[model samples]
Target: MANLYDLLAGGFPIDRDKPAFLLGDGSAVSYGELESGAAQVAGHLIARGVEPGDRVALQAEKSVEGVMTYLGVLKAGAVFLPLNAAYTPAEVDYFLGDAEPRLFLTDPAAFVAEARTAEPLAAAVPRADGDLASLIYTSGTTGRSKGAMLSHGNLAANAVALHEIWGFTPGDVLLHALPIFHVHGLFVALHCAFLSGAPMVWLPKFDDAQVLAGLARSTVMMGVPTFYTRLLANPGFSGEMAAHMRLFISGSAPLLESTFAEFEQRTGMRILERYGMSEAVIITSNPLTGERIPGSVGYPLPGVELRIGGGEATGVIEIRGPSVFSAYWRMPEKTAEEFTADGFFITGDVGRQDADGRVWISGRAKDLIISGGYNVYPKEIELVLDEMAGVTESAVVGVPHPDFGEGVVAVVIGAGDEAALIAACRAQLAPYKSPKRIVFVDDLPRNAMGKVQKNLLRERFGSLFMA
Candidate 1:
């Protein structure tokens, strides 16, 4: 398929009457309904002057309409930008200012009303393989969010690779509870279903009781580490309940060895952990029909090239593949700097390959933290903490947590009350960005160049939450 939309919507050939999305309200959206709905929404977008290559930003609640809107963006040949629903108005403003989307969709009623009067497009807008498909914003070390430009080929290639590797079939039912803003949910989970024509048990959000109850109906599930931890704590979730399930995939953050082991012990099935980022939908995944090793993300997907940059046992991971994004939106120089001369995208993650070629991420080259499937930049938190009263300077690092893959910890060199500092952070940042623990220190260790040694801080407080 030349367009990513074709790759997704092409499932119509398999079985148009097949149920595509089984919603929480006991409504089943068939493939034919999804196609018609997406086409109508696309017609509305075209009526509003959305053209190919134009950005269409949506910051709305997760619902059947939300998914249809995403498909509509693609069907209209506009680049879809799904913003986090939890972002404050200020954050939304920043994204709108940067991306400058032609249409900003918010209310679901607007979409539904437009669809009612709209007509299906005679044909999907013509798009080239290299044309941009979506723009996913990821925070940089400098505190500014950079939009990753994912091309049509990038998404299609990854979807095809995952659909085959994960053994997805039309008979499978995916229990999808992940938010649609990120790649794990939007590109990975949704793409697999679209490619294989699989049905999805769609829940608005992850609820322990709801998920446990859905297990009997679902054959597969993809989630972050937190989902597994919460399910393990609930008595309703048991090995018997998951006995018929085909697979359990985890990504968007590292899965702790403890969670992996406990899940296997509780469910009698190992959780398959994978590695991916916004720049690339999925690069490595544990095998679907083989031995899954704990704490390793397993081998690279077919056609993906991965190598260590520094040549050490552990170093920055570089990747080159069709799935890798083309560039950063409107930042040519920054994009050029991120890729190597040989064309490998610098992943910024420090990892190593075992003797069997399984990739293991040790740490991040940049102090980017993934907490509860959300990316938390240390510089963002430090900037907030440094502005607080009685604070000389602050250093933030992510340490291992039993629940969140990594928990944010702020180490301060001045006399600030922990509760007050945390409250200040909670006011300025999102709940996920707020530091979980505060450690008051006399001084922060610095190197010869006067840079704060975050590695030293990580070493000092790695077990803060675990203890």
Candidate 2:
């Protein structure tokens, strides 16, 4: 039986002495070392009575040991559920109550404090391609988070597709700094490197100085838009500094066109922006070899099909592919609602494909503000606000309004004048699309992946128009 673990293990370097991960603390784990560590962790998991299909919830800090735990869960034929380390105990309690995992892994101190115990199984459980590999919970911004059930095939297919598209080779060194709890970091980043036998320069988190230093020795760097923006702010980060680098990829949030242009001008390399969600590991990516458009998420990956539904030019983006997840864990009804009768997952994102087949994301369907019975896409207003002087980024949302039904509200991150920003919006956008109220903050509320928590923004200003 072909398992995802078996596929990943196939990429183990012929020379086992080769480094698998170069840790932040100046230690390197060889391919052979990683295999041994993973095997030991798998033994521990099996000994703890983890059976095939059982959920193993892990909420430990990002470390070499944590990645081994993930691989061990796979080797044990159990479902891996990696929760954000930043999640509070109450939030973890909710997840535990919801998933009811067979085992929970945390820090050593916390494990002792909880006083949980388990016994080993007699043997390792067998797994197939279609079996559940993971249950990654979505950020519960709008409502309760749903656990997207990713199958072994779903993960394997995505890894294979990315390995080919990104042209990952053993010669490449991945500068990994993103959180491992999310799809981008854990699946997309780690899988590509592991499947290609490529070594990774792993960091605890995104530190501009450390990343800049790492770039000298690293060939590939994958990060969010914020990472690029912060790097651009540093005078030390120059085109010469990244001359040895091969590729720079960005995702997890919308990459502002201005930021994209500025990065290209500074680094002399265009960031390859891609689009993906927890339901699908990676759908569309700006081509690795071809022209990487600044604003577009280039083209759909091999084996994935993308189409715009609802409107003529732009609507809800729908997808169907082997990489798409099977279902939302234990939420059959919600899962059924998310997919079309023909099997296409109705991705809640609103987007349009250009004449060249490049996809442009407008905004989320829920983020579209219907003010005065007029449809207003927040991305349109946000684009204008982001270009204004003194503005870094902006999030536009809909607030309840008695007459208009929903009024447009703009939350900005910079010290831009509210009246001037509103005036600027009025100059560019239609009157109904203009922000009725402008809220300024030092920073926008974001999830672990750097995506703006629009639902939280809505909740904060939901009653603004009512007043």
* Best by the lDDT measure: 2
> Pick by TM-score: which candidate is best?
2
What overall lDDT goes with each candidate model? 0.86, 0.87
CA displacement after TM-score superposition, residue 263 of candidate 1 (Å) = 0.9
lDDT of 1: 0.86
Clashing pairs in 2: 47-120
Which portions of model 2 show Cα errors greater than 4 Å? 108-125
- Backbone clashes (count) for model 2: 1
Model 1: CA > 4 A from native: 139-142, 368-467
Question: In candidate 1, what are the lDDT values of residues 97-205, reduced to their tens digit?
Answer: 9999998889755785678688777578878879999999973333578999999999989999999999988889999998888888889999999887888999988
lDDT of 2 by residue, 1-467 (tens): 56687788789888889998887778898987777666666767776677889999989778777787788788889899999999999999999998899998886234322222433222345677789999999988778999999999999999999999998999999999998898999999999999989899989899987898788879999999999989998988999988888899999899999999998898788899999999998999999998998778889999999999876798999999999998998899999999999999999999999888899999899888888889999998989898999888999999899999998999998896789889888998889889998999888998888889999999998888776
Give model 2's TM-score versus the native structure.
Answer: 0.95
lDDT of 1 at 6: 80
